[model samples]
Target: MDLDLALVRAFTTTAGTLHFGRAAEELKTSQQALSKRIARLEELLAVRLFVREGGVRLTEAGERFLPAAHEALAAGGRAVAAVSGAGPAVRIDTWGHLYAPMRTVAQAAQALGPVRLEPGPGRDWPSVAQALLHGGTDLGFGRVHPLPGGRDAGLTQRLVRLEPVDAVVGPDHPLAGADALRPADLREYTLWCPAELTRLDFLRRFADAFGIARRQDGPNLGLDHLVQHLRGDAGCFTLFPADAPLPDHAGLRAVPLVEPVPLYAWSLAWRESARHPLLDTLLRGFTETGRAHRWLDYAPRRDWLPDTDHAKLAEGY
Candidate 1:
């Protein structure tokens, strides 16, 4: 049978403690199992390793073997470190809101070294800012909300894209059949904006620009849930990013509101204190990829609008 490092470590630890009961408790194993393993080690080595007269005690052979067992364990630890490439690894955390941009960052990180990408659900903007300042994450992606006047210092924010927010509706709706729609065109329709919509600067701007007031007690659901409602014809409309993938519902259609308002913005955020070589490489990779793809050159394929400014829309908000 092959000698296992775990077995060796177990034996060594048990031998040091002398008392099998105490060693088993420390290792979180039953005394019977610990004794079996100890017996196996002794049998394999062809020597009696311990004495159990009043309390457990190491025999002559065990005394001679302990130093070699410890040295082997230490050597095993070094081998593991070498094999695993053990070192400081970058941990990047992002909110679910920036999934696409976070994916780009994750791809860039793959080319660098070991990276841990942590995706969290909708976190408030203040928690995001605090995470960066506290060195809780190497990088983050989300909408750029204005920081408190004094708190804006010591962070680098790169505006990546802006996506136009539009009202999504069903095919039977009057506006959905129109060639184009304006905020006034939607006045009579029931608007289904999420509760979180008010907190978003762009969504608020769109509402303000169109003079459309949110319904007082409408269904306050998430983006995906609202999309379902729109498909079911439960309500007339819900606000969504023009570039976002529209759910394929037979009755669902998205109409660009006339006089486009910024609905969403995306940014690459990092702290001034994090001056790692990998960070620089990651930024360069993202820039080169963005420029190569000309990500802004394409328009949302869901609905083709002749007069729609694809370039402006691609500036992903």
Candidate 2:
């Protein structure tokens, strides 16, 4: 029996996402084409792979075949790279380019020197993890607290930065002129966020732990829009990583949140089975930079983190 690598790729990608449209997007193909490929693969294997009843799901065969599918695709990639005399460039993806994660990557890339790193489409954990699993992306930088897959998700991650969070307030805010503020100082003011209060783990936890009375979520138009909204609302403030670049606004001020400060965890993630010559260089770059800047300084007594993040950090993940 012969296996078509393309069909296998389609299968693996679809298996990773369990959604035809998303799988097609990852493969850069139309949904119809992707469905055809999957049908063909099932025909060739003489067994049904997907149960497309109400929603896309794997049949028993597909669940059993997923691991082998990944292995076969990886072998094919290695074969192509071996003969081509040039491996594919490592693709890295992230969200919020203005944040500390991008800064960490930029400095790491400088240390990497010659290995080409291309930008990938994944912006967060689920997308990034899918990309890593299906060969769309080689590496991703973001918070992995609520990991996309379980502990055995065939992925590896290391804590790269423990960035402190700050309160972004309008100039008229009471604490705007202060050098730093204790978490307790924010209890009286409304905590405004771009997304739903429940969706923001760090902010939600901070608000809960500090007994903040009111919180609100509004449209997340963009940084400029958020800045403007925040500028106009002097009684409300939002939290941002201290390193995130704020748009220049005389009416806006980013004051440090201290006295058991809130911290955002940043980690670099990649596939466990991944192999690249420059992987070591990438890790070393982050390690050296982290060592030089004390990026991972997490004092439990003087800081607050989400429960999941705290567990991971406590375990030295």
Best TM-score among the predictions, by candidate number: 2
Off by over 4 Å in 1: 1-83, 86-89, 96-118, 148-153, 187-191, 215-224, 232-235, 257-263, 296-317
lDDT string, candidate 2, 1-317, tens digits: 78999999999888878899999999999999999999999998999999999999999998778767876776777588779866646668885443546676777677666667776545446767766665556678877756433732888778788889988898888888988888889889999877655445666777888999799886556677777777788899888898878876446888898888898888878887764556777888877877778888888789888777766664332
Q: Give the TM-score of candidate 2.
A: 0.79
Candidate 1 Cα lDDT to native: 0.59
The most accurate candidate by lDDT is 2
Model 1: ten consecutive residues of lowest lDDT: 303-312
lDDT of 1 at 140: 68
List model 1 lDDT by residue over 97-194, tens digit each: 52244555554455554433445433645566655654445566766566667464677766554445567787666667766576666666666655
